[model samples]
Target: MKAEQKFMMIFRFTPNFKYQPTEAEMVQMQEQWGGFIGNIAIQEKLISTYQLGFEGKQIAADLSVSEGILISENKTLGGNMVVKANSLEEATTMAKDCPILKMGGTVEIRTITPMGN
Candidate 1:
């Protein structure tokens, strides 16, 4: 069998800063995310995952810093996941269960590559 390769699934979504989810809704979302990650973990394919915070600083070419997250085309990166898969198709199949898709978000899968020595 061929060894698995690592793929990074970058998650993005449009922010609704004015909206606040209710406690129950938050719990439901947590459950959904938990189940999604749990499923991948069960298969031993999950490498790692992360959720980005809203607060951020961006530096420009002139080294000037700006506050807040960057949103392009009405979408901002929400999170990402690294997983082991035989091919991009398999990784995509795994991402199909992502809860973000239900909320009109996107998951972009890219192969992981090493930096030169």
Candidate 2:
């Protein structure tokens, strides 16, 4: 068996502050996300996941702090999931079923690297 490696799935999507999803839509989204995560959890590949709140702060190279999250290229990071896979391709395959993609979002899979001294 191939050794399992840790990978991070970065989810990004376009933000629309003017429009809001209805209660039903919210419930449906919850189910979709739950199913997706559940599948990975069943395989024992899921490590952790996080959902980003819209509110945030950004710091500049000059040590200046700014309000609000950065939305570059019309998209902002929505959340991320860490998983274990045999390879990047395997991790990509797992990310393919992410609910965000159906919502016009993108998922980026990257290998998890530890800090170097």
Candidate 3:
């Protein structure tokens, strides 16, 4: 039988508090998940991994843009990862170790349905 392909895994992070997570906290969180990520990488299941920075920090002020009245703030949903797996169950099992969830973070797992070329 043909094996099921891997899919995209999205992690939604929401701070328990309104403020940004402290550097130490972020480090701790990453450390907690480091083993899991490493395991997946070794298994060649991890396709890509990304840790998003603070959205508020990317904002820029430009007087010519909108008279400094209208500002643009880059808002991101959260961090994400892509993995190869035989089934959603396998993917989910791999995601169970994500550290974000320990910090009250949420993860959304979805399959990557490819479009015909």
Candidate 4:
């Protein structure tokens, strides 16, 4: 049997996001997210997930901590999901159906290397 590796799917969006969808659209997106995650859970691939909040504090290089979501356009760091897969290709194939992409967002997939390697 092939060993399963962990992958983190990071979701991001433009801070100044344009074209706010209607209430129905929002609901549909929410349902899509649920279905996506639910399918993974059913397949026993989901490890964990999180929804990042807008409010956050950042510690600068000088150790100066600043309040608020301190990041650039690429620093939105919206949400993430951890899943187990046999290879990067397999993990990426699973991420192809991500609803974030449909909403003009991005999904960044990163393999989680275990410590003490």
Query: CA lDDT, every prediction?
Result: 0.97, 0.97, 0.71, 0.88
Candidate 3 global CA lDDT score: 0.71
List the lowest-lDDT window of 10 residues for candidate 2: 108-117
Candidate 4 Cα misplacement greater than 4 A, ranges: 17-21
> TM-score, each model?
0.97, 0.97, 0.69, 0.86
Residue 61's lDDT in candidate 4: 88
Q: Which ten residues in a row have the lowest lDDT in candidate 3?
A: 66-75
Residue-wise lDDT of candidate 2 within 2-113, one digit each (tens)? Answer: 8999999999999999999999999999999999999999999999999999998999999999999999999999999999999999999999999999999999999988
The predictions' CA RMSDs to the true structure, in order, are 0.8, 1.0, 6.1, 2.3
User: Per-residue lDDT for 89-111 in model 4, tens only?
Assistant: 99999999988888688899998
lDDT of 3 at 108: 72
